[model samples]
Target: MEEKILTGRLYDVQGFSVQDGPGVRTTAFLKGCPLHCPWCHSPESQAFYKQLSWMSMRCLGVDACKQRCIKACPKNAIELGVTQKDVKTGTDLQLIHVKRDLCDNCGKCADACYVEALYLCGKDYTVDELVNRLLQDKKFYDRSGGGVTISGGEALSQLDFVIAVLKRLKNEGIHTALDTTGYAEWEKIAMTMPYVDLYLYDLKHLNSEKHQAVVGVPNEVILDNALKLAENGKKLQIRIPVIPMFNHDEKNIRDTAQFCKRLGNAVEVVQLLPYHNLGVMKYLRLSDDPVAEATLPNDAYIEKLKRIFEEYGLPVTVH
Candidate 1:
């Protein structure tokens, strides 16, 4: 039998990202996540498949583009303007509409839209192809102590592909980080742990009920996984998204500090990611789902929270 090609779907591969991990790194945003956090940063990471997005801001009026998208789409999924109920205040023309159900995410329409008004969100990459692209930045990683970071709709969701690419990178002596939601089987974690040099762990809430209420999943498994990884001698970068009306209270902040203390020396660093509306536009492009209204936590307030963690003898940083 011929050797099989192992491929994975990723919405984006961002280069020179200082925000993802230490040094200059390439971050591959993979598709498919188990959790449904409304305030997720990458809108495309929610689904496990390819998506078609229409950037109303980029669209020229129908007359100017000469209806190229409509002509390109064989399924008639491209139309002119969304229904009044779906319209937002941004664009008056609302030049194109994507009938998502009818659309199969074909790139013909995206190709026709020279202004990038219509575009596909994800692309499939064979394991070797992805590794080669990442390795291109080896010089930068070498000088900066940076490597590749695999983030997802939960990276472990596509366990085999992630394992393949990370294992390859490890063999090449490059550092690797797994930015995960911690919603996977322990066996999956075990296999990938050896390949990952660092774990970017999401610690959303200490209370399971509140976690489930907001993210559609309880925190028990997530918390359990964190402890296990720490106990197993893995370095962890704990991330907390400070959002109003969810997991932003001082009580929760202090509780998180206590929890970090439990992780002991394995807790490498705690990153406080304040809420931002950066995902609003991306959300609108992906679906008709309501973008949960959130405001940026004030720097002063975030600093105050940082002190709580410091008091517990845990190093904390705000991003």
Candidate 2:
């Protein structure tokens, strides 16, 4: 193999994550996604470029520490303004806002922040460096059946680096999993399949138009890739996010279950991931508006959906 030094933009490395995969996996969240799911919990991971995020709660205002960031910004992107009024204290506080058009994401403002309220969303890490970071939790993986889960914005978006890291992990006998949207080219999927033990595949909608409307991509490619994976004997888990006013109708639920049923034993799990508004704050942090107006499905409704999948002889779980 040619000597490679591929680096991937990472947002987080959450250890002991039982939700992402089997056992206690260390989920490495990669930045940059191809999809724009309205119910995306990790809004920070959507962009391919580095982004500055400001949390108003941690800001001490210009009066407390002076305008270090405003002065440090070379492009004059940082400024002090009365962004909001503190409702509990009834105090008018000046907050730092980034003029996104003028800002070049230099991180000077983030560096100048004493309280670290403002920071960059993505960090670059070489394949070896990331694998080493994840390997630190090898003891936990040895004890449990867990390993590392390469999650994203979408794992396949960074296919080469992901494959490189997965190959290294596999070399160490680590059980690897990939949490993806399955929107990438078929060749890239095939390249990573052998290294990955499990595929936490997302199946948002069966209808192409509805999928494109909500996720900003047609489901044809996703469905085709999924069938290929199943045919290739790669393990799969079809993850469905139960969003209200979107795919919560009875017809949609049955249709999805029937589709998963066709995949047969290739799909080891059909996980119903109910929608939540947890990402609303993340959108605010990035100074962007949320696309999802739908509320989360109730417990009873979630259970009903689970039963529908189970009726198709498919193993189902709600999260």
Best by TM-score: 2
Write the residue-wise lDDT of candidate 1 on 1-319 in tens digits: 9998999999989899997889999999899998998888787899897888988867666777799999999999878874232245444453777887788987899999899888889999999999999999999999999999999888999899999999899999999999998888888998988899999999899999999988988988888888999889999999999998899999999999999899988888999999998888998897766777777788899899999999999988989
Question: Compared with the true structure, what per-residue lDDT tens digits does model 2 show for residues 1-319?
Answer: 8886689999989998998878888999999888998678888899888988888898877776788889989999877766667767777768877787788888888999989888988999998899999999999998999999999999788888999999999999999999999998999999998899999999988899999987899989999999899899989988998888888888999999888877878999989988888888888888745454576678998888888988888998888
Regions more than 4 Å wrong, model 1: 82-94
The stretch of ten residues in a row with the least summed lDDT in candidate 1 is 83-92
Q: TM-score per candidate, in order?
A: 0.93, 0.94
Total clashing pairs for each candidate? 1, 0
lDDT of each: 0.89, 0.88
lDDT of 1: 0.89
Give per-residue lDDT, candidate 2, residue 77. Answer: 88
